[model samples]
Target: MLARIFINRPVLACVFSIVILLLGGISAGLLPVAEYPEVTPPIVRVTAYYPGANALVLADTVAAPIEQQVNGVEKMLYMTSQSNNDGSYTLDVTFAIGTNTNMAQVLVQNRVAIAEPSLPDVVRAIGVTTKKRAADILLAISLDSDVNPATGKPYYDALYMSNFATIQLKDAVSRLEGVGDVFIMGQQDYSMRVWLDPDKLASRNLTVTEVIKVLREQNVQVAAGQVGQPPASRGQDFQYTLSTLGRLIEPKQFDDIVLNTDKNGEITYLKDVSRNTLGAKSEDIMSRLDRRASSGVAVYLLPGANALDTADGIKAKMRELEPRFPPGLKYAIVYDTTPFVRESVHEVQKTLLDAIILVTIVILVFLQDWRSLLLPVIGVLVSLVGTFAVMKVMGFTLNNLTLFGLVLAIGIVVDDAIVVLENIERWMEKGLAAREATMKAMEEITGPIVAITLVLSSVLLPSTALGGLVGQFFRQFAVTISVSMLISAVNAMTMTPALAVLFFRNRKPGKHAEDKEALPWWGFGLLGGLATVWLLTPILGPSLGLTTGEGHGESAPGGLGASLAGLGATLVLAFPGAVGGGVLGWFMVRPVNWTLGFFFRGFNWVFDWATRVYGQIVGWCLRFSAVVLFVYVGLIVLTGFGFSRIPTGFIPMQDKGYLVTNIQLPDSASLERTLEVTDAVEKIALETPGVAHTLCLPG
Candidate 1:
């Protein structure tokens, strides 16, 4: 009944297809592109610092208290802590896969507050910092200074570069949409340092405790009151406010601080026993870009955020601040993970296009008519494109898994159209008119089409019910394939019959004269032109790097000449094969029909032979049903054994076109020694084949 209505109203059927295409196209643009869905567990990190404390002391005083408080937070899957020798304690509390990251953080924060009073006084004073962020590092931005022409050294040192990025760049980037947090590697905030001379202090009979007390007292902030005449006894009223320097901003101010006064009326100043200077808070960590002193800013993506868009926003923000950068200072994106994503998506898109083209050619060949090919081609477009709308509604992204499903669906979706079209064609061959054949075909095959769609969808939909990260990974894939299948079934019932009625003709048998027509000269010209460009691209396209140069007195296989020769050979063979076979039928008309006829006859013969063999096997299986069942059971058992032996993982490992190497040294290793080791590592990495760039962060 649905097919009958659409067969009569061909325009309405086309409108339905157009609507699907429009919705799919729009949804595709709006869908976020990613390498994978959010499979990593949500993590909330608690970090704290304790100056002059070793890893063991930090573990006891800081890590223990925080972990104890945060251990059993709601939805928390597990917790891990690291206490570094540099007085840094980091605790990562991981929640279940789908837990709300913000809620987890709040819960962890509430627990930490209860444990704060039990922590050391210094730790409480320093305060613990909590952050919610994805575990992956989206990208890294490096800030380096240019060489000084006069001295042949960097105009700015690593300390200056690190502080500059922390002050100017970090906050701005953190404010951007989709950016969870920004961290400055090798951070060095400016601080006033007092170099106390024990000898001089001993000579003056001033203890270190006395010096600290005087320094703290002198640097304290004072809130001076206003001087007003509001309540003064009659006469001129004048109001004034008094101001005083609260905290010392310069090192010289600390030098004049009075330390102690003795009975002899002798006063000693802080400058007498100590020297003051402004320097970095810590000089333990150093960053380098290609062996030059630099700072690295690592950016993290928020949970469920689009990484490509966030990376672009970070880059644009950097460009906007480029003009304000200090002289000789510049920034570069040293490491980014988005390029792999972008390239993977592009490759999938190419594969999708190739699949569409291959499907169309196969349909044209099997149908033996250009007009008949439109049924399946249109069916594929509508079904696959419409799946995007379903994906958008399901909160799925255009990631690798979903795209893989789409690629597989191309074959599945085309099946519905072929089934309907073949049924209608069979009716037409039996001396029925186009409309009558379509209506009769729909009446007979509509149930089968609907059943096939449901069966395929049911087979895949069960995967969506899986648990945990594996479920998240396969859910989108299953949904995508099933949605496309459903849409294809609808298209087969409605559009396939309508298009067949419109595209087919009502002709008596043996009317070959009217079907045969002259081939257009322009069609041959277009094919020839395309073939010429395709053949010449290997030779003339320098971007292809197809050089005809000799290496070690041997001709390069990938050279232009060899590439062109190979291309020519492929075209010669393929033109007579599947793809070009259709082209020849389109352009050569009756002249090439004989050749196509002979090739197709051979194909039909092989297909028939295979069908006969399959029929014989089916008959044998029925005759020996018990034996066949036993063999099937044995095969199932074998499959289970093989599956148990195979390695299992959440996802296959992909080379993402980059590598990360973590180098650890002994706890007693000096900063210089760490740098020496890192320098050696960086040099080796740079010299390694396929290594394009390297960034070093040594502490």
Candidate 2:
């Protein structure tokens, strides 16, 4: 019924296809691209700092109380905590892979709130930091300085860079779209370091602790009360608040801080015991870029934020912020995940396009007419464009998995077009008019087309129900393929028949086509199978590396061999693989057409024998159905056993032109010790073959 409506008006089909094409084109640009589906388990971190405590003390005093409260966070899978001898503690609560992190975070935050009262006063004053961790770092930016030609020293030291990054860069970057948090790494905030001399303290008859106490007391910040009365009647006199700039700002201010008032009417100020100098806080982190001392910031993306957008936004922000930076310092992207994502996506797209062109060329080869290629071309184009539109609506991103799904969709979409158009072309070659041929083709193919759609959907749809990370990842793939196949089925019935009816009405029979009947079902089964495999070569082709002229004899300079190799490639290169393949039977036939025919003849002969043998086996199986069932069960068990021996992972690793390596030294290692190991590892990586560079992450 639906096919008849579309067959009557081919114009409507064309309009529908154009609309979908437009929608897909627009959505492709707007869709957020990422490296992987959101498969990482959600993590919420709870942290506290208790000054002057060791790791054991910190764990017992801070980490333990917090973990005890946050242990039962809803949807949480497990919790892990770390305590550092520097008096810092971090409790990390990890939820299930697919849990809604926002809700999980809220639940954990509530629990942590209850435990905050039990924390030490120092820890409480420092504030317990609780947050849901953002997705992986989108970009890492390093702020480095160049040596001044005017001065022997570099423009600014590490302390200046650290303060500038914290105050300037972090805020600018965090304001960008999709950015969750911009963490300033390897930065001990600017501070005044009071270097007290034990010798000076003893001579002054004061303890080192007494000196520290005097300095701390002198740096107190307080809000003083107003000196004037309230303005109950209109202000009779000007009012002012009694306040003092209590906290010391400059190094000179500490000189007046009294360390003690001795027996005599005399005071010993801070300068008597120690010299105060401007510096940064105690160093707990070390960051380096290519062996240069530096500081950096790591930008992260919020959940569901477009990674491509966030990465690009970060770079754009850095560019805008770079100019205002201090003399000789500039921001450079030290690490980025987006480039790999963009390149992989581009490769997959190029492959998909190649496959489509190759399929079209194969259609042209078998049918020997461009008009016969029309319906199949429209089917593929419509299905692909429409799939993107659906993806946007489904909130699916363009990642490796969805791209994989789209790549697989090529075969399904083409298969349907092949059935519809091939049948119509065969009937048309038999001298029937276009309408009569389409009618007859539809009559024979309609039921099978519908059934094929159902079978394909059944095969693919179950994957969407997968319960784990792999299931979430490939759901896009499974849904895409399932949806695309169903779409292809619809197009085959409606648009394909419409196009055949419209185009075939004016067609003239080919001279060779009149002399013989087209290949029968089994003949097409043999030939069509070969054509499909041949068409898949461009997409399935191995990636090759470029060679320099150093090895072996002089290069076999490009000539006819390269040209002919590229001839089929020209189509795929232009329209990409699948599109260019339609140009010729010669393209597929290559140096020897007859050899292909010879191979085809051999295949037919082999298939004939296999079929006869299979028919006999089927008859025997029918007679002994119980034994056949038992044999099938035995094979299933054997297959499971064989598969069990093979190693498995959620998805195979792909070389996306990037590598992420993580190393942890002993838990008790200090920041300096960590950098020692990191530099050693970085040196080894740089010395290794094919390794271009390495970035040691901030400690």
List, residue by residue over 287-309, the lDDT tens digit for candidate 1.
88887789999999888777766
* Clash count list over all predictions: 0, 15
TM-score of 2: 0.74
lDDT of 2 by residue, 1-699 (tens): 666777778899767667877777666655667766777787777878787799899988888888888887788889888898667787878888767878987898899889989988878888987777664777788887798888877787778888999998888887777876777777767778888888988887899777767767778898887755575466657667777879998989987787778789688988877889888774777667666667878887777777766776676667777778876887667777777776676788788888887887676555544466667878888888788888888878888878888888888888898888878777877878778778888889989999998988898899888888778877888888887887788888878898888876766654234322222223333344445545554444322111111222111123234334444443333343223334433255343444544555576678789999999999999999999999999999999999999898855776754567788777667777877788888888778887654656646
Q: Whole-model lDDT for model 2 versus the true structure?
A: 0.74
| Candidate 1 pairs with clashing backbones | none
- Global lDDT of each candidate: 0.81, 0.74
Give, for candidate 1, the lowest lDDT window spanning 10 residues. Answer: 550-559
Candidate 1 lDDT score relative to the true structure = 0.81
| TM, every model | 0.78, 0.74
lDDT of 1 at 391: 88
In model 1, how large is the Cα lDDT of residue 535? 67
Best by TM-score: 1
